[model samples]
Target chain A: MRVLGVDPGLTRCGVGVVEGVAGRPLTMVGVGVVRTPADAELGQRLVAIERGIEAWLDEHRPEFVAVERVFSQHNVRTVMGTAQASAVAMLCAARRGIPVALHTPSEVKAAVTGSGRADKAQVGAMVTRLLRLAEPPKPADAADALALAICHIWRAPAQNRLQQAVAQHALKGPIR
Target chain B: MRVLGVDPGLTRCGVGVVEGVAGRPLTMVGVGVVRTPADAELGQRLVAIERGIEAWLDEHRPEFVAVERVFSQHNVRTVMGTAQASAVAMLCAARRGIPVALHTPSEVKAAVTGSGRADKAQVGAMVTRLLRLAEPPKPADAADALALAICHIWRAPAQNRLQQAVAQHALKGPIR
Candidate 1:
């Protein structure tokens, strides 16, 4: 399976594409950042993000798009921008009928580094090792995006089964 | 001037269009709410918001879009959705090169009711009176949207002059 991961932010949105499935070696397809100037208007920034994300989707054509899930509990000032940027990523994917998945930061860390509480350096190191890159991707955001893509590819099978089970249960009606 | 105002939310995004300038009676061009199912996935909800906002823009062809400024200090659960929705609104306008303006809740209230702390009812009442509506628009969101359009109409003149002054000042040498 091919997946595109997005580490969303207003100033610099990280994007990474990976091709693989669970229990297999994954190959990195592409990785980059979408940057908007800080001095631009909020609307302009969002428009720029939309354009950048669209360009990625157009080139990669991944089966799924994975984005870092935003939590309001994070830094009060930055969380809003993160949420807004993620929304744009999701919207772009959804508009094209591409499936979008959100993985928590901890989930990405745990998936790659085997620990939910791993530090940035640890996560970056693990991502480098897993992707067989000579070195880790820069700016940390790029590494996080690859991590998210890896997590989604690894987890999607079990997640699909769980969703199917729930749907089947719903069809069976309430358990009285 | 024609302005489309948006009271942004995931479930119920309110929109209104008003025409005219400050010190003259404004005319209500349109008013409505765009709703998405609460049970839908977050990505789907955002897509619905984008479609709704785009439709409004296509129909109204307003010169500007005025959206409520979201604050992280608001209810944590809802604030993220508000910010996301507002981002979509701004994105739609900016993509079309229409200017987007943000008005805070207090600013909207103060512009219409002469009190920043005015209750919802007071703002609605004043909106109805100013628009010469038979009654206040239903759902506080819709009323607030019209209020935003009016606020922008009244404030845009002074805002343009201030922006121009700042631009010209930059062109000249610093005061020091």
Candidate 2:
């Protein structure tokens, strides 16, 4: 399956597209960032982000899109932005009828580095090794995006199973 | 100074603009959202977002932009989209040489409700009351956008002071 992984940030959003099939390693198709200025109108900045994502989607045309979920603490402003960003991704995927998946940081880290608490540097290192890259991915955001895609490929079955369980649970009125 | 606040999202990203002076309440000029189709291509949706934001900017030009910073946790896919959306906002501002400021969630909540733990409903209520609106803001995102603008106004002094301190700290480091 072709998958697109994203690492969201207001200033710098990273994107990576990969194509892979069952029992096959994923191949990198594209990776880059959408950046906004430090000084600009909020509406305008959001517009820029929308345009960048659109460009990436047009260029990559991945079948599935993956993104990181927000688990913030004690920061409403940050959380709001995160929620907003998340909504945007969902909207983008939904608009195109593409299935979107969300992965936790720990899940991605563990899938890539075999450690749930791996830091950015460690995760980057593992992604480089797993992908057998000549050089480590530049800018932490890009590396994170790549790792997210890997996590989806590695854990696709589990995720599908989990979704089924959740659906079943919901139908049964919450399994307490 | 004039400040614009954005509550960025995919389906609907809210934008609010306000004018502020020292020790004075910020005046609201405009508030609205950019709506995108959930079933459209990413590029088309982004184009819609860009057009929406541009229209807002053209109607009400604010001097500064305040956006909520995005922080991700579990869902990498979602975070990536959020990051891209945010990049759009930043890029729009940067292109016009407008100053952009990012605020954490807590800071915004604290500024609006005097409590960082306030929920979305609470924040929305407060924003409506503060703005003396005839009715509650249509969508939750719009209310949050207005709140962000208010938060920027209230926190401007502290932010400026913090920036100065950081600048001073950096200046004290060895010159390169």
Compute the lDDT for candidate 2: 0.72
Candidate 2 TM-score over all chains jointly: 0.52
Looking at candidate 1, what is the lDDT of residue B70?
Answer: 88
Clashes of 1: 0
Best by lDDT: 1
Candidate number with greatest TM-score = 1
Report model 1's TM-score to 2 decimal places: 0.91
Model 2: number of backbone collisions:
48
Query: TM-scores across all candidates?
Result: 0.91, 0.52
Chain B global fold similarity (TM-score) for predicted model 1 against the true chain B = 0.90
Candidate 1, DockQ to 2 decimals?
0.39
The DockQ values of the predictions, listed in order, are 0.39, 0.09
Give the per-residue lDDT of model 2 (tens digit) for A40-139. Answer: 5554655566677778888888766788866664254566455445545645654555566788889989988889998999998987877778887889
Candidate 2 lDDT tens digits, B1-176: 67788876657788888777547655778888877776643434554565676677777887778877766653555554455466556656766777778887788899889999999999989888887777778798888888888888777877656767888989899576
